[model samples]
Target: MFFLSLVVLDPLVVVLVGLVRREGIGLAGAVMALDLCGNWWGNWHWLRDDPSQLLRLLPLTLFGVFVVASTLPLHRVVARTTARSETALPSA
Candidate 1:
C-alpha cells in the first residue's frame, strides 16, 4: 500500500507542481510518462514471483538511477522555460 501510494502520489505531485508553476504541458506530460513507466518497472516484481527476479529488478533499478540522474536537468529546463515565457509577457 505504501509503495502503491508512492507510485501514484509522486507523479501526481510532480505534475501538479509543474502545472502550478506554468511549465510547458508537453514537458510535464513527458515527465509524467517517464515517471509512470519508472513506477511500473519499479513495481513489476510484486506482480509475480518468477525465475527472473533479477531481470525484473534490473530495469527497475535502472529506472531509479535514470530518474535520479535526469530530474535535476529536467527541472532546470522547465524552470528556465517558464521563466522565459513569464518575462516575455508585457508588464501590465
Candidate 2:
C-alpha cells in the first residue's frame, strides 16, 4: 500500500511542478512517458529475479520513482527559469 501510494503520488508531483512552470503539454507528456520507461528499464533486472512476486507491482513502483526523480529536477529548473524571466522583464 505504501509503495503503491508512492508510485501514484510521485508522478503527480512531477506533473504539478511542470504545470506550475507552465511547461508545454507536449513536453510534459514526453517527460512522463520517458520517466515511466526509464524506471521500468532500470528495475527490470531486479524484477526478473522474482517475476511473480514483483512483476505485478514493478510498473507502478518504477513509475513512482521516475516521477519523484523527474519532479525534483523540474522543480529546481522551474524555479531558476522563473527567476530569470522575472529578472529579465522590464520594470513596470
Candidate 3:
C-alpha cells in the first residue's frame, strides 16, 4: 500500500526532475506504468484489455524502484554539491 503510493508519487516527482533537468524518455515510461495502475483501479475494462495483470505488480514496482534508485542518488549529489558550495562561500 505504501509502496503503491510511492510509485504513483514518483512520476510526479520525476516529472519535475525531468522538467528541471530537461530529460524524460525513461521517466515517461514511469508515467505509463502509472497509467496502467491508474486504469486498473479506475475501471474493469483495463483487465479485459490486459488480463495478465503484470502492470500493477512487476513492471510498475520495478520501474518505481528504478525511479527511486535513479533519483535518490541524484538528490544526494545535489545535496553534496549544495553543501560544498555553501561552505566555499565567504560569510557576509
Residue 30 lDDT in candidate 3: 59
- lDDT of model 3 at position 36: 55
Regions of model 1 farther than 4 Å from truth: 7-14, 17-52
Candidate lDDT scores, in order, read 0.62, 0.63, 0.60
**What local lDDT does model 3 show for residue 85?**
79
TM-score of every candidate relative to the true structure? 0.53, 0.47, 0.41
Q: Quote the lDDT for 21 in model 3.
A: 41
lDDT for model 2 comes to 0.63
Which of the numbered candidates is closest to the native, going by highest lDDT?
2
Order of the predicted models by lDDT, top scorer first: 2, 1, 3
Q: Decide which is better by TM-score, 1 or 2.
A: 1
Candidate ranking under TM-score, highest first, comes to 1, 2, 3
Better-scoring candidate (TM-score), 1 or 3: 1
Number of clashes recorded per candidate = 0, 0, 0
After TM-score superposition, the amount by which residue 10's alpha carbon in candidate 2 deviates from its true location, in angstroms, is 10
lDDT of 1 by residue, 1-92 (tens): 54565666667667766575434334444554566565666666774666466665566557666655665676777789879888999999
